[model samples]
Target: MARGRKLDIEFCGFGDGWEADNKEKPESGPKETLPPPQHCLVMQREKRRGKPVTLAGEFFLSKEEEKALLGRVKKMLGCGGTLKEGWLEVQGDKAVALRHTLEAEGFRFKK
Candidate 1:
């Protein structure tokens, strides 16, 4: 062996004609069922110039469901909000009031 030299190696034991065989597979097995999804509303408040002026509301919902939910929250809070990247951005610090509204609408939420 030479110093700082590498040797070329080759593997030749495994069969080259290997193939997966599922001919005698069962007709069916136990079906895999996923757990029920959870619906949680998350609200956060961000401060600007030492004053809270923006509230971010995020709800886990499908794309179609998010539009309606965002509109409802914005109207209820009497504030401007937009849906972006699957999140609702309400312009103003309305975390406290928003939590109350969500709870009244049968939604479980967290800060």
Candidate 2:
């Protein structure tokens, strides 16, 4: 019943044994089928300093797919962009060009 610095503690528990399988593990997760790019949306915007930017949205895609697509588009256009809120926001007035690229990639350009 002494209220000194609370430094003493005791606990007991059981954990799963440390034995781990050494065999190569197969990948997990069912293959995710993303909707065709034609199901996506495209738009344009003016950001800070009146910078023109293009955005492609409405993608029924996983985060990995989105990142991969975004990187491919950015590299294809030789520009920069960030993936936000499941959308790809690219810098510059490249909406038209982006739309063409998307179309070539089997994406519909609906803006």
Candidate 3:
């Protein structure tokens, strides 16, 4: 529906937006080749139901990106985790390890 472009003839309303080819493409390569990251990650210790849980806070990402990042975090930590209210909660006090992992993923963080 953009620039009078026909939806039927275009790839629209999906992961990539309409007129995607017209947009500038992002540089693609190994992760380490990227710059100072696109995320500001924060980690903290929290409690729910009187049980300790580690919270990795406030990732500015869309739903799909958040889900993918959460999955990777969980898998890397080898522990159970969930996303809540735009926060990522991993089981136990995993703040230290979480910080390292996030940094490896090119995320910038502060204590």
Candidate 4:
């Protein structure tokens, strides 16, 4: 039981010594676990205007990650590229070169 102002009510156990005995036990729950690391990378080629354009097929990454990867690919191939709808679109065809780079980076391409 408690009496006095709201603040006093909250601090009722103060200085009484009996307050220490009235403390409530904290509740506990299961701990969260992180997901496993991703493996394997997808590769696909798209043709536009009667020409083949090689692009990074699957792009599951944040904006910063996407930007970094796009830059790396463009620099390695000496070409221009864009990140669109979670896909990396590089100008011209560089599928073989891109595949080699991805494989060297510990990612296996699917066909």
lDDT of 1 at 40: 65
Candidate of highest lDDT: 3
Best-to-worst order by lDDT is 3, 2, 4, 1
Q: Per-residue alpha-carbon lDDT of model 4 for 1-95, expressed as tens digits?
A: 46763554774566765655567876444423221134445667888888777777565566666687778878988988788766678778888
Off by over 4 Å in 1: 1-37, 48-57
Tell me which of candidates 3 and 4 scores higher on lDDT.
3
Residue-level error in angstroms, candidate 1, position 15: 41
Task: State each model's C-alpha RMSD to the native.
Answer: 11.6, 8.1, 12.3, 14.6
| Global lDDT of model 4 | 0.67
**Best-to-worst TM-score order:** 2, 3, 4, 1
Candidate 1 local lDDT, 1-111, one digit each (tens) = 888887744564336875568568773455332211344667767776676654444455555567777778888999887777545677777877777776776677553
Report residue 28 deviation for candidate 3 (angstroms): 32
- Candidates in order, TM-scores: namely 0.52, 0.62, 0.62, 0.58
Please give, for residues 1-111, the per-residue lDDT of candidate 3 as tens digits: 579765684444565543546777774433322233755667789798888899876766666777888999999999999888667899988888988888888789874
Worst 10 residues of 3 by lDDT: 27-36
Assess the local accuracy of residue 79 in candidate 4 as a C-alpha lDDT between 0 and 100: 83
Candidate 2 versus the native: TM-score? 0.62
lDDT of 3: 0.76
Flag the better candidate by TM-score, 1 or 4. Answer: 4
How many clashes would you count in candidate 4?
0
